[model samples]
Target: MLIQSIIVGLIIAAAVVYGVVTLSRKRSAFSTKPGCGSDCGCNSGGKKLPS
Candidate 1:
């Protein structure tokens, strides 16, 4: 019984940790600055191209 409880607790903790990490990664991924990278479809160093 105690072992089962411990296992359950561990699973819950792992799930919580996974959730936190996933959310943090998503937040960081969306937190892009101007001209951050090519993924944002903008020029690097925040420079504007000739129109």
Candidate 2:
């Protein structure tokens, strides 16, 4: 019973740590220029007509 409880506690701790790491890294994964990472051509200064 004690071993089971310890295993459960460790699993919960790992989950919490993973959640924090995911949230912390989210900002760095984002880009201010929506088109900079793609070849969508939206980053070009020229205006695009509606298709």
Candidate 3:
């Protein structure tokens, strides 16, 4: 039916919009920081470890 098709289309559009917003938020959060995020596991915080 036409109503069923319209509902499906709306659901798909909503899902796409939600994904875009989530990704943008994550990108902005990372960009606001200077170095890599804390969870990067790089252990390179500009400090030298003991030899």
Best by TM-score: 1
Better of 2 and 3 by lDDT: 3
> What is the per-residue lDDT of model 1 for residues 1-51, given as tens digits with 9 covering 90 to 100?
999999999999999999999999999887876656535355566555565
Candidate 1 Cα lDDT to native: 0.79
lDDT of 3 by residue, 1-51 (tens): 999999999999999999999999999976635554444534566344455
Candidates 1 and 3: which is better by TM-score? Answer: 1
Segments of candidate 3 deviating more than 4 angstroms:
33-51
lDDT winner: 1
Per-residue accuracy of model 2 over 1-51 as CA lDDT, tens digit each: 999999999999999999999987896676445545343455664445456
Task: Name the regions of candidate 1 deviating beyond 4 angstroms.
Answer: 34-43, 48-51
Each prediction's TM-score versus the true structure: 0.69, 0.56, 0.61
Which 10-residue span in candidate 1 carries the lowest summed lDDT?
38-47
Clashing pairs in 2: none
After aligning candidate 1 to the native by TM-score, how far in Å is the CA of 41 from where it should be? 3.9
Ranking by TM-score: 1, 3, 2
